[model samples]
Target: MNYHLFKRAAKLFTSLLGTTLLLSGCQSSPESIVEKITPLNPASDVVPVRVVRIDSSYQLQRAGKPYVIKGAAGVQHFEKIKEKGGNSVRLYAPAYADVLMDKAHQNGLTVMFGLWMKPPYEKFDYYDPKAVAEQQQEVYRQVQRYKNHPALLMWNLGNELDNHYGDFKVYQIVNETVKMIHKLDPNHPVTTTITDGVYAIPSIIHLCPDIDVLTVNVFNKLAQQPVRLAEAGWKGPYIIGEFGGRGWWEAPLTSWEAPLDQSSSDKAEFMQAGFKMTVQDQSSRCLGAYVLYWGNRFEQTDMWLSMFAPTGEKTPMVDMIQTLWTGQKPANQAPQVGAIRVANKLAQADLALEPNTDYPASVPATDPDGDPLRVEWKITRDVDEFHTLPQNRTAPETIPGAIREAKGLNAVIRTPTERGGYRLHVNVYDGQGSVSNNSFPFFVGVLDTPRLGIHMPQYRRY
Candidate 1:
């Protein structure tokens, strides 16, 4: 009887909560809410897709008009990419194109559809004559299905085809495929992504003259941008198909074994700096760049997702991207820290100073959007000078280090050690990934003299 009653109660509670949520949802504006919750049915709204070249200088026409290609790789979190202000996606070939086209259209994002071909890199035979024919057939099927979709931006013939195998026969096949695609659909441009910008194979370039654009994947060595672009000499629009921090191949020899943690704040700063440098330096020749892996993939330990989780919380880098791309700040603002105070028992002054004392410092943050704010505390020491106590670790190491749904603007951080001077840095990140930082410098002094009346027996004997 008790078990049955509990089950009934649970069902009743769930039903009531569902009804309340439904009612609350109904109160919001219909259009805004519909955009958020609308389900996409691919078959429901398929339209004939057509691409018309605007102008050879389309990018030049839109100069300073925020002509940035804020996109991610298709393998990454697609839905999350759209939610995080990504306007385009780069996905691999024929098998994945249809579904990706539907999703991109639904989210109002563009797709750089990649053609499927495993060049000899992974033990695939591109040299086989029959294999080449089959691959062309696959490409035609994909083009026919998605060519009319509103989301189809451009079609990429292959990814890094020039990396491993140097077979001219493959280039001839690529040329033939491009010719076929042009014959079928002259609306969209066809191009292939290459390994390096500077090392363009003459045979491939001369063979694939029908190819509309040239794409290259560049990494940390963006300083070679000027030289690489000059070397290509394609006289056509180009894209930095892939550009970000060092890939697994580009890491230093000593730290090769140490799996890189791209999620760190330092990495974020490095990416932002590199991006700025590349854009400012190579704007003339570069159309736009796609920051790799908009979502996470396990390859080389999930290097590219701007946010940690796909459907979960965002990382600080997301906020940084928005700032870089849109030049807009988050709706809510970060808090400012005015000052910090420290007290210790040990001091050079006459007053009684204590050792191993606990000192409390107050921190405050604010939000402009009136949204609720949270405070995350962190205390770090200079690795070269002093060793930090167990409590002075990163947020993950400390208990309840990150506080969400916090009521007050101010929070108190406790100091565990009373010894050396330390730098206290506080990071306040809102639920939306907007962050602000504040730091304070403090030192604890040692007591110089003991109580006058209280004397040791050993000292008197001496």
Candidate 2:
């Protein structure tokens, strides 16, 4: 933070906060760190934000007004989100926290800033008081520095910590951190995202009640949240921190055992259904939802859940979300390329091919903008987890060589001479900065089960 920005934030603190008091510094006593960085909640002119109960329902009241979060979870494309009628953005970590806060404020978008917490999965031992206090010291600094920032909506304490986790002691840190935040900044509420509904909600209810609102990153299972929450005995306000298409772990698997990636249109349709079921269906405890991956990145494929592609082209999911938010679509839309088919069969079919043999593959697609589309085909090596290397996991296209012979919508793929598992990828590009992508996973030889070519962040082994 620079001098001018600090001055501007200080001005907002003067107008909104009751008392703009500064802590001495980011110092935490090893013996009692949470005690050292204590909280001070004075009477304020306005309640910056809080989760309020209304009869049998709940909603977010910000500045004395009911606010629903129509949000996206990424750092880029803030201007576009504002145009599409999104009022909030969720940051995953602190790398761009202050910068995104400033940008979000400029765009009139509030932020659900995510405080990156290390769980036992990352070998962060909650049992060790020294380590726990060191982390609290850092958290204290972050809250005190930006607590009065105008764009700060809420603090997401952690993300999905209960997935593949076994430590109950972590909640103590969470509770202590939330306690510190409540004292330092009373304007915004603190939330910790974990595996949703039946799986982790109960533990939070039992172990961590200091969390003001329950935030979840659910997928296709979003519709089941009501039952799951009820079963877990959580009857409070909640927000869909992240939601999109079905994850590859849940998607249909090929005979080779590789998960088939959903088409661009398929993802948009799934997101549309999810948004309707949860946000639009309008559960009493349900606040609005946030569509995910505002920028493009690879999990299953190059463009599995990203709202925008690497070329800065928006996906159809973007259009669907805009429609859901504003009841209107974009002036220009992305190309709707249905599932890529192999041998005139869908990718879901048993896509087993001979080694080094030519196969017929094509993706039927149409551009809504009527921009001439360049359909390019390539061979991607989607290997099992045993063979998944760093390069292949991060950048798939750079491996297994390109199918130079394969061009246009209709193309013949010359398979690799020796392949265990591979994928036929089709990427349709419109000259107008839009792209539609899909992939078909197939085996080289007769194989029943190939390796899983996916990344599970929760169960990462050290």
Candidate 3:
């Protein structure tokens, strides 16, 4: 999950950054900020969203008051997001836009509708007049359709349209589109999602002047965003469009080139720390953040980047997020996980593994609430990256008949006979619906797999 937000701790940062919507040069103190700004638009009314300067900082203004976007990139669990103290949900596509808006509105959550710009990926020439006109019309339709919705809060013009791309025309398009949005929907502010790199800010500053806020879909360096942007000379407001731990491209991989995924518990710590560093700590100019997937999707494996499991069960990541968002702990906490071991060696394919052989694997984990832990085991082949992209995403396929036996925190798994890279997936449950998911990669082949120093470039995978 990449979508996220932080509205609960508004009081905590309001003192430090002055009040939201307290125009920088206004002759008022923090107490006067509310009186000057908090006007009401009652009865199903959605006031325009704006990014206002508060002296040296910025805050998002909604309904004539400060709004912290405790949001998610995914749309599932609107009720749960509200229950967990989130105030917004980002609808990423045009699919059932009105329906989602209704759900979010009913749940008392705001919506940031995302309109994707995919011309570059499809190789549609940016300079083509007919194509540009068609794209603009499509965007216009979306804006005109949902601009008046009471649940609508803001707009994400494009999601990560700047990774390994340098057309400059893309920035021009984003600028033009954002300008159009401001005129058609003057009430809502417009933001565009890009990769974590600050290198694109110069282009954004030069071309996309209408962008009110910059949304960075970040990984690996979640806490450093504000510092990086300031160094790159972008003084505008921003939000974390997607913060889902580390990217698969930046993950640690085995000698066989399979990535090592985090246990659910470890992921919890990582995500919690990231949220604190960015949303809670950097609220001066940072609006809020969105957790990547509120639902489940395949980035590398289901367990690699998702907060919820396929069965709608919550992982430690969710538990951690709930704790941060609401300040209340769950009755039963998810288990904390360590590494999986095979024959006394870490199950990272660092040792020799032979095909068709049955090996013992044990998981290391503990529960914070002293609950009993049960382990479930499954075997899956490594993801076939050849056929996977953001548009054509794929989860790892389970290999039937590979798991021979499963017991408490341990399993006897038979290596695949095909002699390829495989993973032993483990799920540790605390019996109270809380879980810790983890996996390790192992090669089924012999020494034919090279021991050469592996070098995987860190690319931004959105």
Candidate 4:
């Protein structure tokens, strides 16, 4: 074999292996180096705006009052959907312009109208001259037609084009299209949503100069958002154009493989956590985010849309989201606590409780906005009496009050009682009718070893 050919073959093999790892969802080498940079800290007193164009940066005001968009995909529900939280709806194409604009106007919700482009990821062949003229005409027609709608929030130039191609020609087309739209509708800004993790900030900034805000679709990796945004150096206004738990691409086919069916509980957990992480943690320059597939009948996996079945029974996730966005905990629902652990051990096993011994236990909880979470602790020799504790301590003494800070309800239980086997139980109430109780058995062995003996009488006494 030629020596040069062998080296090239080796390089090809390495590249293929890396791609395979990425597609297989295995850990791959980090794509870019992370550098420490100071995050922008907006003034504490600044009032949040839902969609405000400030200089070059767009600011989405944090929902002043809890607002939930009970929206559906398509132009059908424009007039009927109450949009309890905030009045907002997203429209996909010019074809639905009259229906959507009229319905949104009547229903009192703002619209994020998308400017549809041609099929296939490739750019219109500007060199062909015919393609360029066609694109310009199409763009101008769209800009002139929808510029005067009061429901319009921002103009979406395209949807998910970044995943298919990265040609500068496409960017140039988009840049020109945005410019035309701005000229026609200068009152509204331009935006476009990309498939998650495909577009780079620098490339768009350099190529698409007329674009105003950046929107991205994210699922599953919502927790790592701050780091991802910082690394991408996204200085413009941003929004989670799509988020929630398992998108069609994310969910597994069977529970045996990886709990892929997306249980109601799991979906609820995802919405709650995702909202807190995105809106609460990164709301400074972050504009509002939209949950994906608001109302599409996806034939492929039949799982991306947010509506219920024929009977119209909303999933637990929907109910959870209503509470989160509206800040009105349901009257019958409460926080749920699960995955409880004690001393780094699973909570199901027995634990040792001795004087001066630190009995740390972690209790994870989820609350569907109806009632505030109140955790009650109880300890007794008889497992039957585990519901009642020594001092009837129901309120949190040391637990972090803020849900974001506690990392999901972890606390250390200090036993003042003497050496003995005891059953410990944690009862969590959502103040609604919903309640969850967890129990664990622990043995407090006598401190016979001198090294482990309690020296202070106060520590030894129960």
Instruction: Please give the distance, in angstroms, between residue 362's alpha carbon in candidate 2 and its true position after superposition.
Output: 0.9
RMSD list, candidates in order: 21.0, 10.3, 11.8, 18.7
Which residue runs does candidate 2 get wrong by more than 4 Å?
Answer: 1-47, 383-393, 399-407, 448-462
Cα distance off (Å), candidate 1, residue 96? 4.7
Q: Which segments of model 4 are wrong by more than 4 Å? A: 1-83, 122-128, 252-259, 330-462
Q: Give one digit per residue, the lDDT tens place, for model 4 in 108-218.
A: 777777887653344444334345445556656665665556666677887766654544345655775677666655666788776666444567778786677777767
Q: Candidate 1's error at 123, in angstroms?
A: 2.8
Candidate 1 vs. truth: CA RMSD? 21.0
Clashes of each: 9, 3, 19, 17
Which candidate do you rate higher for TM-score, 1 or 3? 3
- Highest lDDT model number: 3
Worst 10 residues of 4 by lDDT: 453-462
Give the TM-scores of the predictions, in the order they appear: 0.58, 0.84, 0.87, 0.56
lDDT of each: 0.53, 0.75, 0.76, 0.53
Clash pairs of candidate 2? Answer: 39-183, 40-183, 384-451
Better of 1 and 4 by TM-score: 1
lDDT of 4 at 46: 24
lDDT ranking of the models:
3, 2, 4, 1
- Residue-by-residue lDDT tens digits, candidate 2, 1-462: 999979866754453232112122344332234444332222432239888888999888789899899999988899989988899999877786767888998899988988878866668866555566667777766776667777778999987777557545577568767887788678899998876536566667777889898888888687787667778788888889888887665566655557768888888888887778777776678877788888877766767778887778887888888999999988888898887777688866666678777777787899988889988777777845434532467756544444636657888777777768787777888887678888888777766544443323332211
TM-score of 4: 0.56
